[model samples]
Target: MDIVQTQDLRKRYGKVDRVCDLSLHVPEKKVYGFLGPNGAGKTTTLKMILGLIHPSDGGVTLFGQPMDGKNRLSLLRDVGSLIESPSYYGHLTGLENMVVAARMRGLGMAEIDEALGAVRLSEAKDRRVREYSLGMKQRLGLAIAILGRPKLLILDEPTNGLDPAGIQEIRELIISLPIRYGMTVLISSHLLSEIDQMADVVGVINEGQLIFEDKLSALHALSQQALAIRTTDNHAAGELLTAAKVAWQRSEDYLLLNRLRDDNVARLSQILVAKGIGLLRIEERQSSLEDIFLRITGGAVSL
Candidate 1:
């Protein structure tokens, strides 16, 4: 079942559409990677889903029910979110900070400890939040979000500005959520590599529109393979390729051809050999995820 669904949801500011007709299906107990480049309206789409802002068109559905003003809050009661950044008192200890948030929501202190521990911040729970590193603070925000053990979690650029280690820490924590806590995660990020590592499903948006949505493996399958050939005499190999009218690109060490068949490979090999160009190596190279992303989005976003 889809824990969250949006049907042609749109958000417009002035004459420009910040989030166009967008639909997303987030399955229960799965990590849904809401991917886009900066300024691609990932946050706008997320906000509309959470009812943080009203959509100019269409609507959002949560937990299999249509979300309206009447029941939006109750529907979101089982949801936890850390959007943009977490708010906390700088002078308070991490534990104290959690205490404040818990009291505001009428939750118990015991749950705070479990949340902090789950985020691996229990070792420094007594430290002042002002002294916490950016990573620690981010983890604390995560801890607060999970305080109620919400069934669904929404995170916006959770790993933004994080170091490699911090990013990995958050990645592992997110990956464990569905398994350990039975939570569904809706994580948004501009980084394809991050989503590649952590998401079971992916939704790609660009220019305020949903471009692609599918399983992580399905996205990977969209990448096409190219033939990479390294020959002893590259210039000679280039000449042969030119004469054969085969479209190719010559890098410093290798020549690249697009999706050649087995017979084409044999034909090219025979031609090169007949011309005394020693083929040192030949291999197939799949386009990277970044490459596929750029292609899918029509180069609208960088990284």
Candidate 2:
């Protein structure tokens, strides 16, 4: 069942539409990656989902119940979110900060140890938050979010600005939540690689538009198979291949064709040999997911 669903969700600011007609499906017990480039309205969409901000049109449903001004808080009781950044007192110790959050959430003090340990922050509980590293601070925020062991966890760029070690550490931690506590995680990130590593299902948004939504494998399959070939006479080879009803493109030193069958490859090799053309190289190639993402977004991410 869908733990969270949004229908034609839209958020408009003045003449600009930050999020437009987005419908998202987040399945239970799966990690959902809200993938988008920076400023593609990821945060806006997330805020609307959380009911922290209202959309100009459309609506959100959490746990099959539509959210509104009345039942938003109660509906969100089982949802834990760390949007953008987690707020904390710099001067306070980690445990002290968690204590405050526990009180706010009406959770018992024992929950603090559980949450901290889950995020591997228990050892740092006595350290001043201000003295902690950036990664430590992020873990602390995550600890607070998981304090009551909510059924759903929403995190926005949780690994943002962290080193490789920190990103991997957080990624591993997020990946474990579904089985450890049975959480359905919704993590938003501009970095495609991070989403590729962490998400089972993906929703891609770009330029305020919901471009693609599917399982990770579906996105990977968008760019079909191909063959990359280079010959001594690409100029003549292009004509011969074209005459043979083969489609291809000139890329650097190779002619990239939309996948030829095994028999077709053999035929092409013989034909080239008969034409007195030296076959330099011929190999199969698959389009990378990153390339497909750029193609689908029209390179709008760079903007």
**Number of the top TM-score candidate:** 2
- Model 1, which residues run further than 4 Å from truth? 230-255, 259-267, 275-277
The lDDT, on a scale of 0 to 1, for candidate 1 is: 0.92
lDDT of 1 by residue, 49-131 (tens): 88989999999999999999999989988999999998888899999999988886789978998899899999999999999
Scanning candidate 2 in windows of ten residues, the lowest lDDT window is 294-303
Error of 2 at 265 (Å): 1.0
Question: Which ranges of candidate 2 are over 4 A from the true structure?
Answer: none
| Overall lDDT per candidate, in order of appearance | 0.92, 0.92
TM-score of each: 0.90, 0.97
